[model samples]
Target: MTLLLTPVSLADRVEVITPGGNASLTPPAASTEPSDAAVETFPRTTAATGSGGTTYSPAEMDTQPGLQTMHFGAASLACKVASSTTDLVVINQSPEPLPAGTRIKWQLKKEGTRGFFAIIGELGGGESLVADDVLDGQAGKDDICIARVI
Candidate 1:
């Protein structure tokens, strides 16, 4: 099985669960103007700033296969997964002194289910796991994979 990485637009809105409630995060390439949803849901909007804290330079990051870029205080964390063979290889492409806890979790939508229902494996900070199949104990290859930093 092979998985191709898709680069999501910086303008694309990313929703996350924050302390206040549901907050919409704006990346480096996000829009300045506010959205109608934000206007209607003032308190819910909370903060619209980039979740990465610092901006990412072009030379630093891009939409590469199995590569997940995360922004820290002054350092940029690049999680790269080697060739997408039968087992997926996830690597840490950053400098030494890695963070204590940086985990990435993934969820897959079942085929017959209406949407993403099944839960998959998760990677924490500098840890790597073998991502063979999508669903738990299944060998199917038509599952939708969605990943998030947890």
Candidate 2:
């Protein structure tokens, strides 16, 4: 897995916030993923308490920067920030094509807790999902955490 901590002004159209003293990203953090079949997620909220385990990033960046790609199983995951309130733009750009009727799993995490803002639907080789706002239809959370796509 990959953990990105892109440094940017919080005043910009996008704001990235990590825990105190976690304002940096170098070589991306080391995170482990589920086995080839099962998928799991950890939120920034639970990052500090050792809740999600030691494989997750302590900081979260705006997905608005777009397309953080990862390879696992039979596909490559391309995650992008559509908007915090709406949903993410996940594309399958696998070098090896997935089998027919293949589906992918995804989850967007939150901060200070092991809860999810949205649990997206399984996507196909050329499909996407919109993980609507979990904050009761208001704006999305500014915590801007990480996601698990498999």
* True-vs-predicted CA distance for residue 57, candidate 1, Å: 37
Model 1: lDDT of residue 111: 36
lDDT of 1 by residue, 31-84 (tens): 876655432322332333756544433344423335454554333233222244
lDDT of each: 0.40, 0.46
Evaluated against the true structure, the overall lDDT of model 1 is: 0.40
Q: Name the 10 consecutive residues with the lowest summed lDDT in model 1.
A: 111-120
Q: Provide the RMSD of all predictions against the true structure, rounded to 1 decimal.
A: 23.4, 25.2
lDDT of 2 by residue, 38-130 (tens): 334545443456355554456655353244444556666555446664545556565544443333344444423222323234455665555
Report the Cα lDDT for candidate 2. Answer: 0.46
Q: Candidate 2: which stretches are off by over 4 Å?
A: 1-74, 111-150
Where is the poorest 10-residue window by lDDT in model 2?
111-120
Q: Please give the TM-score that candidate 2 achieves against the real structure.
A: 0.28
Instruction: Give TM-scores for every candidate, taking all chains together and pairing residue i with residue i.
Output: 0.24, 0.28
